[model samples]
Target: MGSDCFDESFHGYGEFWCLGDTRPYMRALGAIANLAHRLGDVDKSIAASTEALRLCHGDNMGQRFVLSSLLLKAGRFSDALSFCQVWLDPQYDGLNRPRGGCEFNPPNPELLTARLVEWHSKPWSPGNLLLNAAYAAFGLWGDCELARQYLVLGTRANPNIFVKVLARREKPDGPYSRPRTTNGTDEAHDYRWLTQDLWAEPEAWVWINTNRDVIDIVVKTCAREGCGRREMRPLDFKKCGGCRQAFYCGPECQREDWQAHRQACRQANAPPAPPDSPVYAMSGFLNDEGALDAMTLDNSDDSSDLSDLWEYGVEVEPY
Candidate 1:
């Protein structure tokens, strides 16, 4: 009688079936999450989205994106940032696979290669992910400097993101009938449409407005340890080919800075070490005390410190 009453179509039951996690089941769960969000039950929506992500580990349905936004909406700022870190970047399974796995964050090597996307050279250049990451970082830590870095990268990924969404006073209009282009105005509109309320908080809104200028400010000074010389105009300084983030006045300065920049350059070009990797654990044991912290933008004892000003904290005087 019990067996007869049970619905065979529902895959959420059964010991051997792995909860019937088929594509349809995942989609249905995703829809429920969306509905919950629309209904203003943010916590419930986050739960639903998180479950969907766990069930379909690779996030083939792009549930991670939704989950990320929901996390911020629910005030789970740290979780949102951590989630972005784990999922956004490329994860290489060096021991077993020749290249890397597509299942990225949690490292599911069996996932398809098609699931893998090319990581932009700039770490934060992946549309909403890094943008949310920046917001989450600020929300969690109140560290404007770190948040600014994420903001910069996020803007690079989608140039229209800031102006189209954050800058405007009016909500972006959209039937959203037209297909969205990658990093285009339509994409920005859709993003704004989805997460408009999250950015409206007084503190969050102020942070966005204050830091928005950094995206437009180009720092053309030499990125060497001690020599901070700004060019009169653009193109005077040569950017390092390795990371393309660091600029040098000349080859001599570049050569002098190589020692300081080597580790960071390698990290920028290559996939980051896994969180569980021994590299992170052994860092303290290997390096001198405070050695890692000493690698600053300007470690010089000269006026270079004044020239190599950070975009976030420094104050300016009126003419």
Candidate 2:
């Protein structure tokens, strides 16, 4: 009945029919272990592969290799190393080949080539594997020179692989290098043409400093004030009363208590000014004397008491 069942199970599959009853269970368990390992459940993978190895009696080299790989993934370095040593032993060379009378070339060279290429492309590949093994051996077995050798190899493969390797190296402690100021001044260079002198234009200046804190403050203040593309005006200077350190559009705006600028103005203007001296002269006021003299003539001979004077001449009333 068991044979019949096995035959029924193996009916459609060529490999199943060939390898017979035991091979199916061994292959199935091995596949499951590989799947578990890929899923990152290393413990389950180790268990499944161990069961497969027990059932196969160490005959399946492929299964053994997979188990060894799983052991490495699970961080069982000693066991994995032992397994790899045994598998790669000269005595096991013939055993690594496919079973007798198998039509397929036993150890497919194409698969090996593809695997090697894939492993070589990995960030931590053959080099990392060797270094890790060497380091592990040295650290656990009190071999300092071996550890140093592995450390060197690891650094050559990937400098960042070991943190200690970089511990002694110095890194830039300040901002990155940038173009130097053209004038060779410590002040930062300004690129805005508006800040430069141009013909048929009034000269203006801009102070550019590399001090990031000051730049940040200016940018933030401009944003908070809703200042837009409109050029900052001189009248804006009136709004900054406290220290004359800020600006606005005009006096009306400065007086607009809604922005609480009046308080600032009061604070600024509150400081006492020196009294004007007699030596300080004031400018002349506007004069209307010429117009007053032109209207001073008298005319009283007309029949109409004030008709001619009212019409064409200046009337001087006797009062």
Candidate 3:
């Protein structure tokens, strides 16, 4: 029962024997995937599940089912569905019907397969339903109607879990909670809060406070900024000369003053000021003059956006 005993027993087994022994490997991979998920490593979970699927090759319905589960968790609904359908199809059903063997005989492989097929067919039962819905909504996979169908089914099967999974995958970056101040007040106050100041900044702080590495933040910011759309090559922040916080599509973008990123660059390089300083005390400053100018221009074009900025600026002195 102990891990040492299992390890000792497992070591003597040959690779083909280990790979062919569906149940143990399936269980191991499933556990790995589940642990990875709980630890917030969806990519690891996906990798483990993919391995499980590969090992399940022939007739391993249990492993196949588990593979689908992990793929769903990883937001690969279409792939999960393909995996499910492969084994669940009527032609494959007999292949999955377990042959009686020593020390490991599935009680009812047909019944299990039937249950899984039914579950997967419903567009809900399996967790992948929500994943499919998300892909559908983003127009990554299918039509909105199909997405709606999956969403409805997914919600119907397990509303709370479905919603949670959808919300989590939608943000793949992580959960969305209003940031708390040191005093624990909701820190998000305005657009500036959304953009400037660590205490007030939403995305960067979300990345920093959540313990995400700098490289991860750069990758995410690039994705959000549609670097892919611009045909821009990815920038490696690790090689950056300064604060190493900001990432750009290229040297031109890095030099583009229009983005008003110098302040962020400066803050990244500048040592932390005293806690009592207005920049810290007021939460943040509008040091990005280009951003300010853009805002001013935008306000002149459309008064509504500026009204809140004007009111907030008047009520709170510039840091």
Candidate 4:
């Protein structure tokens, strides 16, 4: 079926699909990706997944989940890490939301929700992405430090899912199966992954809400040597004028930090390099897909937590 699905040579291309109807083509590529993964062809899986992502309505459900998992399974940890981080990026909508020229039903409505359609859409999926990041960190880079950091964030995002993750962390058992969340009040409302059975320990799910710290601790640290104050530092951040990467408590700290920051800063301030990859870019282009044009470019919805308070269903304190 995978081969049949991808056999464009004998495909029946009617005008019905020229406009174009991306549903079948996207599914075919996705199928091919899975087939390649099962065959242990990592590069082929990524290539198929990447091309599938290029289809007009290709941001359908399970796309990123498949791509990320396949990248991990292939032992392409760096690629997997980069892919997961970017997809997890709230600003980039490829995996964050449904976008593309055409509309197709997501593979699992329960796992992946479509926001614009509301009742008709189910954009939220159960996969815990931060866990994948942790894996990409530890498995790929052997960076347990980074893995623990991501784990902290992952656990905070879905503590319910973390219950199982932490349990497995303690056990380190083989054949890691799909772990479900028990936090929700109703058992029927539980969330699970689409590719649970395939990998010994792939990724898991996050449901309902977020519990990540309102502000990241690292992002708030003062740049100056003497004053590395942690929190209550300031709601308002003062960014360096040079690299614009470093933040400080105020102008005084920014000036003070400059001497020490200058040497390392020169390298980053150097001439721009070529685009990293077809799937990654710093600005202007959105890698190759440009899927952000759909659903996200409008900017009607912001990723900030304060934005969550605006939701009608969100439980918030009354003024």
Candidate 5:
């Protein structure tokens, strides 16, 4: 959803650096697949989700989540079960650790994405997915042993999630990623607002997700209004120097659209808030009674405090 995150691309990377995928392409691919499913394009949905899974090396729960759901829908019970069980395995290690999310074990992508909004979606933990796969195994394939083992594993993983998080706190693993904010202020709320803007609306999410061409990397119409010129490449448009949020058809279109562009420029230049530090929030949750009372929470609004960090998790990937 943002510029490239590859170490190779960072010749001091920023928006202007490139308009390609940030590394770990699973999130966008998953979103595209999910959007396709919503549109009832089952074949396209599976294709997108399957491609996402193919790119994953067991690190991304989001990809696993989408692929498993699509497999079940496609009646690929064995593949679904096998995929989820691998994640459930204690030894299922990858280049990066599984994103159990800033909260909850076996992080649920749909719930995490919709946490700020009033939405009901299931989590994607190995335990939950195992149960899903088990249901399919027993019902669809008549595989009793597989179903039983999966159920056992699912239940075991479910109970131990919070415990594992607590243990993580007790035993320091390594320095975790810290939260960064613009203007040295609390950025969590701002981040939640962005995700809410992106995700809270069903149509908007689909529109944005579908429109971007990070894969095919082609565009016909200009991003600017009233400038529907054709014949495009990925880097054809000139990115606005001010906010870095938009790309002009050219210098002429940018100058011509200056009046409307001013407001956007401010927003683009404005520093986006960062999500709350995962470690800090988890620790606060564990000590909810009084431990977090002294913590300086930014009273940006009365909307939500936790949603900020939740949205931040998605913002890092922006799909």
Candidate 6:
């Protein structure tokens, strides 16, 4: 099946599904992504996972987790964070939350928008999601405060995340094979194992090491250079409409800080360039029925923490 079939089925049934089920197509794409990732084809894996997410609007197969991992691995920091935001605040972003049985809607636009959605930036609880978001913020944007908030949230959701992430270990090259549980050690280990190389980089490791002891996540200070006021809740601080990272005590602080923060703000909020060409072609492998069937069959045991969170019966608290 291709885009034509995906579109026909998507519009015909109001949801692209197979035999009253949505997993087969999504699973096939995910399997393709996993196979590509295992073979070190990051770009192909990202594209495949991205297509998987588009097909399964409800993310029944947890394609977002795979996409996020690949984006970060490829060092597409801005893209990773931007992709993660689609699920952060569906209402604010005009995103259709398909979990409520809504009509199918693709998560990202073909022509990516630069409009920032900051009214509700709190991410749903999952150590890996928080960790990925944190890495994206810190990577090229160099926004340590935003990264710190994510790290704090990840630590709160799963206490063992930082320890395992910062530990020295051989990074696993394939998709995580174990069942994941919400806020469990398994979830932490899975994230740590898959993303070990990202953290192993000197810059990322130093940042994690430097901020490892920061647990007082309750209060955040104004972004203005001289303003020392801090607020426990984000509602009390006004966020910069451009970057959505800077928080101000009031308009006075924001106005005063504009000149100093303009360049970074623009850079942070700019729409990313289109994805680079895939490093390798896998059409032959995908077309091989036997290979596709085998890969999909083996994916039955592969579950992501975000996908399994609800099934694990845990209430996700906002940080």
Candidate 4 lDDT over 1-319, as tens digits, reads 3344333343532111223445566557767876776676878977877666544233542356556656566666676666655555445554333222112222111221244123211223223555566656666544345555554554444333433222222222221122212121111112123223222343322311121331342125776788977534223444454444465677667556666777665655455454453222312212123232111111111122131121211122212
Best prediction by TM-score: 6
- C-alpha TM-score for every candidate: 0.51, 0.28, 0.29, 0.38, 0.34, 0.54
**Candidate 5 vs 6: which has more TM-score:** 6
lDDT of each: 0.54, 0.33, 0.34, 0.42, 0.39, 0.55
| Per-residue accuracy of model 1 over 1-319 as CA lDDT, tens digit each | 2343224333432211123325556667777887887788988888777666554444544566677788788787777776776655566221211111112233222221333333443322457777787788888667566666666667666655565445443565432444333444555565676676777778877776666344343325788877978754434555555555577888777777777776776566575466456444322210111122111121111222233222211122211
Off by over 4 Å in 5: 1-27, 94-125, 140-143, 155-319
Error (Å) of candidate 6 at residue 96 is 4.6
Task: Report per-prediction Cα RMSD to one decimal.
Answer: 16.5, 38.9, 20.7, 17.4, 21.1, 18.1
Off by over 4 Å in 6: 1-4, 12-14, 17-22, 90-124, 212-319
Clash tally, candidates in order = 0, 1, 0, 11, 0, 0
Tens-digit lDDT track of model 2 for 40-123:
688897787666544333343234434544555555656554453344334544443222111112211111244433433333
How well does candidate 5 match the true structure in TM-score terms?
Answer: 0.34
**lDDT string, candidate 3, 80-180, tens digits:** 44454344345543343221011111212122244543554442133332333333232334333444344344334323232222122122232113322
What clash pairs does model 1 have? none
Error of 1 at 127 (Å): 1.6
In model 5, how many backbone clashes occur? 0
Point out the higher-scoring one by lDDT: 1 or 3.
Answer: 1
Single out the weakest 10-residue window by summed lDDT for candidate 4. Answer: 293-302
Clashing pairs in 2: 236-248
lDDT of 5 by residue, 1-319 (tens): 3254333244523221123343334446656775786676766877776554443343232444445555556666555555654555444443322322111133222211223221111122334455445544544444345554443343333322212221121222221123322111122222221112222235423332343321122232454679876434433444554444355666666666666666756655555344375422422211111123222222121222222111211112212
Misplaced by over 4 Å in model 4 are 1-20, 56-58, 93-127, 158-319
Model with the higher lDDT, candidate 1 or 2: 1
